[model samples]
Target chain A: MDSELPPLLVLGPPAVFNIFKSQYPHKYRFLNAFSSDLPLLQFLQTQNTHPSSVRAIFCNQRQLVTADIIRSLPSLGIIATSTVGYDHIDTTECRRRGIQIATLGSQFAADVADMAVALLIDVIFKISAGDRFVKKLVPFKPWSFPSDSKLGGKRIGIIGLGRIGAEVAKRLEAFDCIIMYHSRNKNPSVSYTFYSNVLDLASDSDVLVLCCPLTEQTKYIVNKEVMLALGKDGIIVNIGRGALVDENELVQCLMKGEIRGAGLDVFENEPYVPKELFSLDNVVLSPHAAALTLDCFMDSCRHVAKSLDAFFSS
Target chain B: MDSELPPLLVLGPPAVFNIFKSQYPHKYRFLNAFSSDLPLLQFLQTQNTHPSSVRAIFCNQRQLVTADIIRSLPSLGIIATSTVGYDHIDTTECRRRGIQIATLGSQFAADVADMAVALLIDVIFKISAGDRFVKKLVPFKPWSFPSDSKLGGKRIGIIGLGRIGAEVAKRLEAFDCIIMYHSRNKNPSVSYTFYSNVLDLASDSDVLVLCCPLTEQTKYIVNKEVMLALGKDGIIVNIGRGALVDENELVQCLMKGEIRGAGLDVFENEPYVPKELFSLDNVVLSPHAAALTLDCFMDSCRHVAKSLDAFFSS
Candidate 1:
C-alpha cells in the first residue's frame, strides 16, 4: 500500500467516508473531516507537516468550505467537487498548480434538473412549508385554509445551458408552461430561447430559477439590480450556492414583496441562516440539502473511492 | 333566433361546453349539469313535466339513469358525458331509446394524470402534510426536516388504463420509477404489464393509485382483502372516487401500517371528512382539490352555458 502512491485527501461531504472505505479498499489513505471549514491550512502548514503525503483534494460546496483550504494542500494532484458548481474551489489556483479537476459526469444533468423541478414545485406549491404544518402530530381543521396557487400555464426561466439545464427542459414537457432561458449559447436540446442577460430571464419569468454556478464570471448574479428588474408577482429558486445571490438584495426583495417568494435549499451562512429568512411564509428554506439522496451519496462516495484506487494503482 | 333549433341534450362531464357553444351558436339550446348524480335526476324529473320538448340526454355513470330519463323526454336524440367512464348512462337504455350517446372526445386525462403524479409524490413525500405545516404561519426548524423519501428507483403501480390512466403513463416517463398497472384489457399505450386483479397490483406496488372509477364492479374494490395483500410497505392514492375504496379498510391499513401511507383527494363523503382519518401523519388529505383549478372551474361553467345555448337554440 505504501510503495505505490501518496494518500488521498477527501475534504467535504460527510457522506463520502463510507463510500471511500468500501470502494477503494486498502488504496490511498483517506483524510476526511466531518465538518466543512476544517483548518486544512493550519493543519498542513504546521512546521513539521509532510505535504508529499497528500495526493488529491476532493470537495463539495457546502459543509462550510473555504477556497484557501484547497490551495494549502500541496500534494493535491486532483481537485474534484461532487457538485456541478465549483465556485467553492479556487479553480484558478488549481489550474496554475496543474491539478486535474473533475466534477460529476455530464450525464448527471438530470440530478440538478430534476432537483430544479423539486424546488420549483416546492416554491409554487409551498410544499416543504406545508409538510411541516401537517406533521404537527395532531389533527386540526384540515379543510379550513387558504387556497394554494396552481402551477399550470405559469412561466419559468432557466439561466444556464449546461447538462442540468437541458434535463430540466425535457422533464417540464407536459406542464403546459411557457419556457424561456438565458443561456450563454442557444441549446439544440429544446427550442428554448437564449436571453442575453439575467435581466431578460428575471423580467418575464413568473418563476426564476438560478441554475448557473457561482463564480467570478457569475458571482452575485442575482443582485439588487436584477431583483428590481424581476419585480413582484415573481418567485425565485436557487439550488446553486448562496453567494451567487446577494443576501441583502434577496432579503429586501422578499421583505418588500418585490418578489412574491423564494425556495432556497442553500443559504448565505448555511448553519447560521438569517433570522428574517426563516420567518417568511412565502419562502421555503432547506439547509443545503438539494443534491442529496441515498443514491447520490452512495454513488459519489464510490466514485471518489475508485479515483483513490487509480491514484494508488498507477 | 326563433328559426334556429335548440341543441340536443347530452350527459357527462361539463368540460365539453366550449366546443358546442362556439361551433353550434344560436342553432342549439343546451341542458347541462356539472355532475351525473341523483340530484340531477330528481331535478330533471321535476323539470320535464312533458317529454315532447326534450331532445337528448347526455350522461355518465352516477345515478340510476336509463330509458326512463330518455322516455320522459321524447324529443331527446343525443346523450353525452364529457368523460370516458360511461357507467351511469346505461348504453343499453340509450340503444333502446334510439339516443346517440356521445362523450367528450378529450377528457379529464391531463388533469387526472397530473393529479396522479401529485398524489404519488404527495403520498410518498407527504405533500398535504407539508402544505399544512407551511400554512401554520410558524417558525420551523428548516435544517432538521428532510425532504422525506425520494421517487428514484421505486416501484410504482397504476390501476385502470383508460384516458386518464394513459396520461399517467406519459408523465411518469421522466421519473426513474418502475411502472406496472392493472386493467381489464391489455393497454397498448406503453410497455407496462397488466395485473389480473387488485391483489397482484397491491403485492408488488410501492404505491397504488386508484385510477378506475367507482362502479358496482369496482366498488369496495380496495377492501380489507386487498389491504392485506398490500402488506406493510405500500402506499395508496385515490382520485377515482371514495366509494371505490372501503374507507374502513383505509383507516385500518393506516393505523396498523399494513400500508405505509396514503394521499386522498376525494372521499366517499366529501366536504365532510371522516374524523378518524384526520390524526394520521401517514396520510395526506385534500378537499378533492386536484381538479379544482381555475381552468377546471371556467371549463365547467362554460360547459353548462353551452348546453343551455344548445337547448335554447333548438
Candidate 2:
C-alpha cells in the first residue's frame, strides 16, 4: 500500500470531525461539491493510479452519481452511503465492475417512526401552532388544550410495509391503533390485514401513513381522489418520500376539509413550501427531517468506518 | 329530572356534547357559572332540595372542590369527571358523604399512553422546535433535519404500573426498551421489575415516567435527589400529576443536566410556568391536557350517562 496517498475516497459532506480528520487525514480524501467536475475528475483519475490502494466511494441519501464517476474509480472496491435507499447508485453498473456497494439499513427506523408519531401528535394536538406561540417569544402562552381525536380504536393505514412502516405499527400497537397496511407485496409474518387498493386502506384508516418508495406506481398516491375516500377528519402522515403525495391535491383537500389534516416530513420539492400548506392550521410540516439525528449519524459513521476497514483488509 | 335543566352540573370547561356553564353561551339557561366563589356549598344546599332531579355533578380535572362542597350536595349521588385522576374532587369527602365517585378508566389508557410516546418523541426529535423554525410564519425555512434517535435497547422505567403504564410498556415493547417499574403495590401480571426505591428506578431507567397517582407519600417523589440520581441524559415524563414532580428541583436539575429533559403534561403550578423552565428549552410542557381529548372526554360523557342510567334505574 502506498504510504503517501489517501487510502480511501469518501464522497460526501465534509463535516468538521476533528478526531476523524486528524487521526487519518492522509488515509482519507473527501470528494465533495468541489471535487466532482471535469477537471477535478481528471485530477482524481490521476490520483487513483496508485496500484497499492483503492479509493472508497461514499455518498449521502440525496446525491446522484454518474456512470463516468463510477468508471473513474478503477481502484474502487467499496461504495458506502449513509442511507437505506441506494437507488441513486447505478447498482447494475457496479455489479459489472466488481464493486461492493453498502448502504445504511433501518438504522433510522425508530427515529423516523418516532418522527411520524411525533407528527401525528403534532397535527392532532396542534404542536406546530403551539410552538409558534412559544417562538414569537410570545408575551402570553395560548390556552391550547388537547384536540378532538385519539389514536385508540382508530384504524391506522400504513403504506409500504417496510422497515420503518413495521416499526410504526409496533409502536402504535401500544396506543391501540388498529393496524391496516397496504403494500405491493404481502408480509405474512406481520399479521396486518392486506388491502387490495391503497384508496381502500385510506377509506378505512383514521390516519393514513405514506411509507412507500418513490416510484411511478406510487406517485401522488394520496391525491385528492384518495383523500376524499379517506373522509374529512382523517389524518395523513408521510415519512417515506415527498413525491408519494400530490402536494397540490393534499393542500386543497386540507383547505376544504375533504381530509382533516396532515403531518408532512417531506414535500414535492426540496426546500420549497407549497402555498396551500401555510393556509391550513391542520398541517404540521418539517424540512424532510424524518431520518436526521445525532445518534443516527454517529451510527452511520461507525458503519462506514467498519465497511472501509473491511474493504482495506480484503 | 326537570326537562328544562341539564341533569349534570359540569364544573369546568365543557366539550361540544359535555355541557358546562363556562363554555356554554349566556343564552343557555341550563348552564351557569359561579364567579369568585359565590358560596357553591350554600348554593348546592338549595339546589339539592330538588332531589328528584340533578342526579350527578361533573367537574374539570383542575377544579378544586373542598370537603365542605362535597358535604353540601345531598342529592349528588354520583360525582364524575373525564380524567383518571380524582384528587381534585375530594374523594374522601365523597366517600364520607356516601356519594359514589367515578372517573374515566382503562378506555383512555392507550390515548394517554400515546401522548406520553408523543411527548417523548417531541422532546428527543425536537419536533416542536423544528416545526416552529420551518413553518411557523418564520422568515426562512431554516435548514432542518430529522432527529435520528432509535428507541431500541434503552431501559425505560414506569413509576406506576397501572392501566396507562402497562399500555405504554406494551407500546414500547416492539421498540425493545427494557421496561422497569416501581409502584407501592406490584401486580403480578406484568413482566417488568418492581423497584422499591425511586432513586434506584431513576438510576436504572433511560426514561422515567411518573404515572402513579398523587398522594401525600407520592408527592414530590421526583425531587432533587431523584433527579440527581437520574444522571445527565436520562429523560423524565410526567403524565400523572404535576405535584408528583418538584418544580423547583426539576428546574435546577434540568439546568444542571442532572437529568436530561422532561416531557410534562401536568405541573405543580400549571399554566404558571416557573420562570426557570421558560428560560430552559430542555423541557416539553403541555397544559395539563394529557387525557382531555375530545373523543376521550365524549367517551367519558357516554360512560357517565350509562352509569347514571343504571344507577337511577336501580
Worst 10 residues of 1 chain A by lDDT: A138-147
Instruction: Give lDDT tens digits, candidate 1, residues B1-314.
Output: 53245534445434335554565566555555443354544645554424476665544344346657666766776665544455567667778767665543344567656666766665554434433443343346342222335565667778777777777666666666677888777767578867888788888878777888667888888888787787787788887778778997788778887878887766776445676676675676655555544455455445544554464455
Give the interface RMSD of each candidate: 5.2, 3.0
Interface RMSD, prediction 2: 3.0
lDDT of 2 at B304: 61
lDDT of each: 0.63, 0.72
lDDT per residue, candidate 2, A1-314, as tens digits? 44455555545442313334554556665434435654545555666534325467767645555677677667777788777666567777789988888777776777788778789878887655554443334446555555567776778999988988998888777667799899998888978889979889888889999877777688888888888889988999998778788888888888888888889888777567786676455888876777676666667777767777787777
Taking candidate 1, what TM-score does its chain B reach relative to the real chain B?
0.74
TM-score versus the correct structure, for each prediction = 0.74, 0.86
User: What are the candidates' individual DockQ scores?
Assistant: 0.14, 0.44
lDDT of 2 by residue, B42-88 (tens): 45455553433555766666577667656555667887666677777
- Residue A276 lDDT, candidate 1, scale 0-100: 77
